[model samples]
Target chain A: MRIVVQEAPFDFAAEAQGFSRGLSGMGAVVTFSGLVRDDDGRLAAMEIEHYPGMTEKAIRAIAEEAQARWSLGDLLVIHRHGLLAPGETIMMVATAARHRAEAFEAAEFLMDYLKSRAPFWKKELTADGAEWVAAKDEDEAALDRW
Target chain B: MDVLYFAWVRERIGLPKERVETSAATVRELVDELRAREARYEAAFADLSALRVAVDQDLADFDAPLAGVRELAFFPPMTGG
Candidate 1:
């Protein structure tokens, strides 16, 4: 398992390709990427702030939990912080397992945990002003399943 | 101990982090001390339910004891992915 918390943009295609390669024992690989949404077309940018030391620790814990719960060959988590423009990739998760079910389940589990467990905060900047994105009740409730 | 704030909490507190010397035994007591200092702290901590605390970088409750804690952080609900 690998966890990366960085500010620089990552090449999703290259990362995915690298993750898929050299996994001789794995039969399935699943990857998910989150992008900065520009729903209203008025967005100027998105700013992400995160606690330096705690972010990596929290993500590692979540990734380890996913590994423990699933029979996985490998997994990767990459989350970016700081200023990002619309259409930029914010984060990505990739999971490899012996079967498709395990790969998909682990990927979803990682996404769900990372959504709430990590210490990153997002602020949306628009033409009017910048606003901190509120945490949705639905996102918290999504953890009830596990 | 070092006290840190993030997101709206940092904005409300008007600073990112600071060194705090306190005798409080728990997170609640430390919060009380901060609240007694100024209106900004009072306003920042007005609603405990709206805030989250971390002891030494691990999420903790307000009632968690501060024994041996070198760092404490306050922030809103995390919206990360």
Candidate 2:
């Protein structure tokens, strides 16, 4: 299990390459990427802020939980903090498991928990001004289902 | 007692961090004690509506005891993705 939380951009290709390094048995690698989206359909970019210690702990815990639930060989969760552009990637999750179901389900579970459970706050920069986005009820609902 | 503020909670508090000491028992008790300490704490904690509390490095509740907790953090609802 590998988890990295930093401000610099990440190389998805490199990460995918690393994920494919040790594959001896029949398996699948499920990957997911989260981007800065204009939820309000506003402008410029998104400013993401996070508590360094808490953010890492929360993400690591999520990864650990996923590993406990599945027989994963390699797991990588990369998250970026600070300012990010609209098209820029904010985070990525990769799960390597023996079967497609476990790999995909574990990746999705980690993403869902990270989005709603983790301690990251985002503010949208628009033509008008900047406003912090609230935790939507739908997000909470999504996690509750899982 | 270095009080660390984080995320939107720090933005609203207008200070990223501060330090203080008090004879509060639990996390909730410390909050009440801080609210009484000054106007800044009161304003910062004016609305516990959306606030989340953490003791040491673990996600704790307002009612969680802070007797031996080293670091205390306060923040708003998480928005991580």
Candidate 3:
């Protein structure tokens, strides 16, 4: 498993290809990428803040839980922290497994956990002003299914 | 112990982190001590329901003990993905 928490923007294509080729026995690979949305077309940038010591630890625990519950070959989670424009990528999760079901399910599980459990906080800067993005109730409720 | 704030809490408190010396046994008690320090702290911690706490870099409840905690953080609910 590979986990990265960085401020530099990652090359999505290269990372995705590297993850897929690194696995030896996996038959399926699933990837999810999150991007900052500018729904109103007024977003200036997003400032992400996280606890340096705790962010990696929390994500590692979540990834290990995914590995334990699913039969998988490997997984990768890359999250970015810092100021980013609306078009930039926020994070990505890639899961590889022997079958499609395990790969897809594990990817969804990781996404759900990352959405709420991680220590990262996002503040949206728009024309009006900067405001912290509130956590959605649906995001927390999504975890109950798993 | 080092007390940290993030997001709105940090903005409202006007600082990112500070060293705190407290005899409070739990997070709730520690908050009470902080609230008594200044009006800024009281305003920042006005609503516990909208806040989240982490003790020693781990997510913890407000009633969680702080016996050996070296770091404590307060922030709003995470909006990560």
Counting clashing residue pairs in each candidate, in order, gives 0, 0, 0
DockQ score of the complex predicted as candidate 1: 0.94
Off by over 4 Å in 3: none
| Cα RMSD of predicted structure 1 | 0.7
TM-score of chain B of 1: 0.98
Pairs with backbone N, CA or C atoms under 3 Å apart (clashes), candidate 2: none
Q: Considering the two chains of model 3, state its CAPRI-style docking category.
A: high
Interface RMSD over true interface Cα atoms for each candidate: 0.5, 1.3, 0.6
The candidate with the higher DockQ, 1 or 3, is: 1
lDDT tens digits, residues A63-114, model 3? Answer: 9999999988999999999999998999999999999999999999999999
> Each model's C-alpha lDDT?
0.95, 0.83, 0.95
Specify the highest-DockQ model's number.
1
Q: Write down the C-alpha DockQ for each prediction.
A: 0.94, 0.77, 0.89
